[model samples]
Target: MSEGISVVRVTSADLPPLHGQRFDQAIAEGRHGEMRWLAEKADRRQSPKAIWPDAKSVLVCGLNYGPDSDPRATLGMGNTATISVYARNRDYHDVFKGALKRTGQWLASRYGAGVKVFVDTAPVLEKPLAQQAGLGWQGKHTNLVSRSFGSWLFLGEIFTTLDLPPDPPEFDHCGSCRRCLDACPTGAIDAPYRLDARRCISYLTIEHGGPIRRDLRPLMGNRIYGCDDCLAACPWNRFAKAGQELKLQARDDLRAPKLRELAGLDDPGFRALFSGSPIKRIGRDRFVRNVLIAIGNSGERGFLDVVATLLDDTAPVVRGAAVWALRRLAEPAQAAAERARRLPGEADATVRAEWTEAMD
Candidate 1:
């Protein structure tokens, strides 16, 4: 077991009747954005028994991933990209799952029970289960907030046939606290406990495959991978402890990576740099698409040349984002010259539309 795991509590496999109602509501309203998987697995995500009928208990585990310093410090550093604190090192899915597997193995040996583990891979509604296990309550930002670990926990679950005593669920402590709502760079947290993933920077940067919405690009600032503004804003973090797992600690290179350096990454470089990291899952085209948006929001004319280089990029999304960034950083004359120079040869309708939108 990794010493990084801060808390572990058990809950009965049976969940509340209204366990995943909000998820259904979010899906029905199309608030989950491009993440169709959420809706597809709606039934299985409702309860542990839905996924596995034999499961009698759930072990909810929290791994502290608190940043050594405030992760929001890089937000104003326009020339640098702000990766979410959780993604700055190795992917937590791997780290957390390893610990869960070891724990599950022990449970299986001791009780001769059937066991299965999950770490964001399954259709498990982890936050709700974690809350049910007394780890924390779902805060206004719609993330599990731990009293001991604060908002920095990486959660996983082990489903076993071993019937265990359930812990009392934690109640909401965010009474009259709207700091998380106000901290959102985009108004993704429309209401307390309500998150519209469409406007969420994390969803926009990491999940959405195509070009980002033009209106939300400016609000994203330099968050190229995921946004942590809401999570960092919670006052409960004062009690949080920095993660002790060496593999999960932040890598110095990713802390405040220069936008220009990141924008220059080709597929091989992107894969190599983000090897074993969560950022690589998005692929180079989407990753660079995010980098271009960050470049556009940087307000640094020095990035104009870098943006220009990506105009002829093979990926339509990359080309489109480059056009948007070019318009944002280049002067009217320079933008016109590049538009004239590149627009004639541009084949993708989306890239042409980006040019037109930038011109407009």
Candidate 2:
């Protein structure tokens, strides 16, 4: 019998060690580019035993947070920001952690056993642990795809000293479907199951510090916070309905923020707007960086004034991206004249390069 949530139990010995090898190889090959933390914490992320020495059983839990509507529907709406559904409202790390604490406390009280909860914050290889516990298998997009909820599950884990019964591992069922791979605008999914985070729009937008690659910017469109293209392309998502988590549901404003409005946000204003949302983690400058990319891709001249003002923003990344956007919307000579005046005072090498490129 399955509750709305899927639970997986695994022993230390049954944990997925292969993830370590693959993660290591990816890090060594630079596939995990700019996210050096993955390599920094690789050892502990290998398994439950690595995180907790005395752990005998691991409980992997899946909470479905599917969106009410197709997030991809906003992709063509060039003038607005398209935030990833998971981040539109509240931060899941906070919401999920609260849920896990309550659940873990109940389990501890009932069994009188020692328990520890680990959400996305910990270096836990949750997807492998979830599959090992039989919640779902990793689809070709490298995300756990549930037959019930598709690609919209948020994973959490509990490591307990009690030796509990473990469920069988779920096997792969992606077959030959390459919809997710082909659907990536930046070709982040280079192969069936392999993901190059460097080329990933989500990584470039949210994680990577400083300016994004010049060549990849055009493919990013209006996706400001994170991308949901591959997840949206999953055929298994036909079963996904509206998410029920009050804290995780899409906020009306975040559903589609105008790029121009987002572009004009100062640091304090940005903080107030994204207060509890995960989008705030990227900070005002980075968030503005992402918005500038969307403004450039929007092919709309409405953002010219905002984008031009942002050329003088404190953050080099924001200034550089604004330069890119202005170049896209401004006339060649108009952009050149603005650059000729602004370039004299701009000190950041990256922003200077963007000005040079805009002139070209």
Candidate 3:
């Protein structure tokens, strides 16, 4: 019973139907694909209180990270890889956590009790909590959509012992619009609010380890990192404004970098290029693997030399992707000659197998 603390008891009816039971089921069924962490704590992810018993109410907040220009405008440039809007600058998890922590500390100082800050790192189902906090409603893509920021906002939360009056939940305004579902290149969003991460381009390129599925590779286009087709296609974004935070603004180097240049990056080069950017987390091997796939899609034979250099790469993953790119770049005879040179020295069996297949 903290002084000046308002309280609003949420009825069971006010909670999301089944209380995120469907999300749990989706994870359990392997719909989350390579994101094993989500499935590891499936039960706790459904309820905020389950994460911390002392938590009486959850304070959810949103940070608008919308770009001033169209995020999709760079796609037509062909050679450049499109990094998702969220990853353009400092990682949102680090940026938003700092903001949430400051807000939580202030609330804790006033309330004098339990308080915790959570960004994407926690198991909390942030979208539902945001909706419950009256921040926004879950849109058709299952992402929280704010009237103020639309779907371009990043969500963070503060769990506290203080019994603050809960804001009424926002109503879903998606009404009859299926743009998000229709726009998904991989059909990741099966229905209005359901997303199968296995089919999601973002999940395949970023979250999933190892080589991407053969079928999904071409569909990825030049999006080497994450896909924003679903988010960009949303009509709600018309109301969204560019983020005021300096750290979240898009960098010019990343806007539309040439695919050939990206494919040519060595380990040191990759580190220097992506320093302080979220794309650095994927490392050079995976980054090159993605670039090679994009080179194959570019239909530009100019990148063949860049792809050829990676045939001798230390990492098998990169080599395999290079082999795949060579097959796409040249006629069978030329691809076969390139594959023959690497097949003898290839250390990884998987890469050797891919090279052998290319030579045949």
Better of 2 and 3 by TM-score: 2
Instruction: Assess every candidate by TM-score.
Output: 0.98, 0.96, 0.92
From the highest TM-score down, the ranking of the candidates is 1, 2, 3
Residue-level lDDT of model 1, residues 1-360, one tens digit each, is 445466899999977769788788889999999999999999998899999999999999988898999999999788999999989989998988888888888888988989999989899989999898999999999999989988999898899998888999999999999999999989999999999999999999899999888989989999999999999999999999898889989999999999999999999999999999999999999999999999998899999888988998999999999999988888999999898898888999999999988789
Model 2 Cα lDDT, one tens digit per residue, 4-103? 3434445443465578888778888899888878889998877778888888888787777898888988886878789999999888888877777777
- Each candidate's root-mean-square deviation in Å? 1.0, 1.8, 3.9
Top candidate when judged by TM-score against the true structure: 1
Error of 2 at 168 (Å): 1.5
Q: Kindly list the per-residue Cα lDDT of model 3 for residues 114-148, writing each as its tens digit.
A: 78877787887777767777777888897878777
The candidate maximizing lDDT is 1
lDDT at position 72, candidate 2:
86
What is the alpha-carbon lDDT of model 2 when measured against the actual structure?
Answer: 0.85
